[model samples]
Target chain A: MKQFFIKNRISLSVLIAFLIFTGISFFADYQPGKAISKEYFFQFFKEMIFFLPIMFVLIGLGDVWINRDKVEKHIGKDSGLKGIILVMLLSMAQVGPLYGAFPVTYLLWKKGASVRNIFIYIGAFCTIKIPMLTFEIGFLGWKFSLLRTLVSIPAIIIIGIVMEKMVGKKDFTIKQP
Target chain B: MKLLIAFSVIAIVISFIADKRKTFSGIKSGMVMFFKLLPVIISVLIVVSIVLFLIPQEMIIKYLGEESGLTGYIFAAITGSVALIPGFIAYPMAGMLVKSGVGYSVIAVFITTLMMVGIFTLPIEIRFFGRKVSLLRNLFFFIAAILIGLFISLFYNL
Candidate 1:
């Protein structure tokens, strides 16, 4: 219990801060956001609350479903280009806010995914996801989305290669003694 | 309303099943975990609001406007990185830029790098991933950001 509390201190601080801010916003004469409507605010909160369960389920399943050793073996340097591509694709499929990504990245580290590949995964998670791309296209236009996607692919690849060399060590993998 | 209810039901069911399975500390613990993230989520929202409130759209155009050329793009990418708006806000802002004659390519690069690279999240990232890994990753993304913009520009023209 103590260790768990220690590990989660930052998250707890953020939660406290959020509660205080929310309390102030409710009590004080806080001006609402301009572009965001009151209706939109409620709706966004509603969606977030609604999505929490799904997120929990996914996280829970990942804890059990993911094969730690196989995940590492496949993504290790010895796994070569195909492994890299697989790692990239899997990372791209991950969803949620940047912070939401950390738990999974930590899991991958525990599981033996290379730190370099994890960097690439994080980059791809940011840039190369299909849903994000589809949304970008829907909102901004196909030309903008396509251009962004094209650029991201090579950039993620390059980032992966460069980081792989510079880091001088793969992340904690099952292959490690 | 029905769709909303349906989604809620699905979420509840999933949560129940997760609990039943006793996985990852079950549904109640998961809910607690989810609530724990609320502060980070709220902080992100507050920061987005701050950017919108402080920075005028016109100023963004002047610096990141099409007429500004290569320098404009670099400025735009940096601005986008620092502004820290969500994609929902950023893309529309990019649209306004386009209507105001900002290059599509610049907006593309700005949004891409803005979402991917974290100038603001550096401390947190360092804590999570260690310094060298975080530094190398962020630096690589920053450089790739330039090429991303340039490539988008060419691709659209082609």
Candidate 2:
């Protein structure tokens, strides 16, 4: 039981927090905080319900489908600028939370992707990619979409350069700490 | 009460399956992770709801309407930076902004940059990526955000 609790600390913490909040909410006055809390509770659950299946499938694919070695051959640091663009494209293709990109980025690092390229991947993951921007342009407008993409290009390059200078080539490795 | 009962039943069934499959570790750990995320999840919800309730669309339009000059620009960026909504939420919000005499350019800049740059997630990003990288990334993003805003403003102004 102790081991189980330790292992599931994240989940357990959430459960405890939820229960505590619920209890407090029940007794609390009808202030803005309480009202907002009540609304949030429902909204949080709704989003979680919507997001979970997608999260799980992505997790499963990470474990089974992706071939880190295969990706590395074409996009490793040794491949230079070409490598960076390829890796950036791959990162753009990926879905899920931006954090979900980290493990994959770490793996690519081990395979010898430059720190600069890793920065590109991270930047691109956050910025609008082709897949998502299409919907965004339709929903919003083309000029808006185009401007966003334009801004992102330079941002990605600048981030790539900055990351290289700050982190250097020392920290990135295949070995898990 | 209804959702609580439903969730509890699902949780119980999941736990039972884990017990039977002897995959208790993964299932148990997943739950624990869920529990840990509870605080942030709740806080975000609270903030979102408050924004939704307290910040009226009319107020935003009066201040941030297309013809409002630089104030409109700053307001759009501030609103975009602080607001945390899914793309779906943002899309309709943008549509409303356009219809309400708010600049399409402003809406575009706000929605695009909002999704890309996160003020709320900064601490988390710093914790995960370290201060150096986070600072650089965010600084770059801020510039990108402003540029995107300016470009849209110019484009639609024409």
Candidate 3:
């Protein structure tokens, strides 16, 4: 119990603060604000519950089954433009909030995927995913959405390369827990 | 969601048949990852709720055109980083902002950063990528968001 509390102290305090604020809002008669906040909170919670398990399951399966050699060959240091295209396609296929991508990203790192490709995966996952694109087109017009996609492709690549360069040849380790 | 669940189910079934021990180990790692992430994710969501309470939806809408010149664009960018509206709602809101004479550039910046650069998800990101990479990732996207806005405005009048 003590170890758990110590490890999770930051989150516990934040949770407590949330409860206190909700209580204060309840007392101060600011019902609407508190209600809306709660509504949004539950909505996101629902999304997290829906996606996280399945996403992590898939990531774990990949961790066990996917060969490091394959990851290195496809998205590794010498993979070049093909790796870029591949990561973009991989990211586009995903459907979730950005947080869900992190585990998969970590898995790819452990499997020897290149830094640039990793960043590209993240950049593409967040921005140009297929489902989000259609919604954007439906609401913001196909032209706007297409233009954004067009602009995003090169921008994502550039940023990824820049990130790789900024971090230099140094590759840091993130322990698998 | 249905499609994802279906695929995961198929994958799990196949993996279990192929090698039960490996499958179980895979699932164990996944569960460990899930529990590790839950606290940070929950705390982040709670903080997000606080943001929603303070700013509210309408206030975000209002921020788009409240200031003149570059300040309005900056405000829109900052609001995009902070606000957590879903894409369905957010895209339509962008349309509304455009209709209300907010430039496409500002709207571009708003949506780009809104999706790519999550202020609320920073802690979760730090957990995976560390402080420097996460912060730099957001910073790069922030600058890219601005440039995306400029490019969109340059390419199309609408």
Using TM-score, give the best candidate's number: 3
TM-score of 2: 0.69
Per-residue lDDT for A65-146 in model 1, tens only?
5687887789855667777788778866655556556555655666667756776678878887765677677767886776
Alpha carbon deviation, residue A79, candidate 3 (Å): 0.6
**Cα error of candidate 2 at position B60, Å:** 4.2
Which window of 10 residues has the lowest lDDT sum in candidate 3 chain A?
A168-177
Give lDDT tens digits, candidate 1, residues B48-147. Answer: 4445456766677666764467887778777766665555666677777778777777887688777877765554465556677777777778778878
Compute the lDDT for candidate 3: 0.85
What is the lDDT for A93 in model 3? 87
lDDT (C-alpha) at residue A119 in model 3:
92
**Candidates arranged by TM-score, highest first:** 3, 1, 2
Q: What is the lDDT of residue A162 in candidate 1?
A: 78
lDDT (Cα atoms) of all candidates against the true structure: 0.64, 0.60, 0.85
Q: Which candidate should be chosen as best, given lDDT against the real structure?
A: 3
DockQ of each: 0.34, 0.19, 0.68
Of 1 and 3, the candidate ranking higher by TM-score: 3
Badly placed stretches (over 4 Å) of model 1 are A1-53, A168-177, B1-45, B56-62, B156-158
**TM-score comparison, 2 vs 3, better candidate:** 3
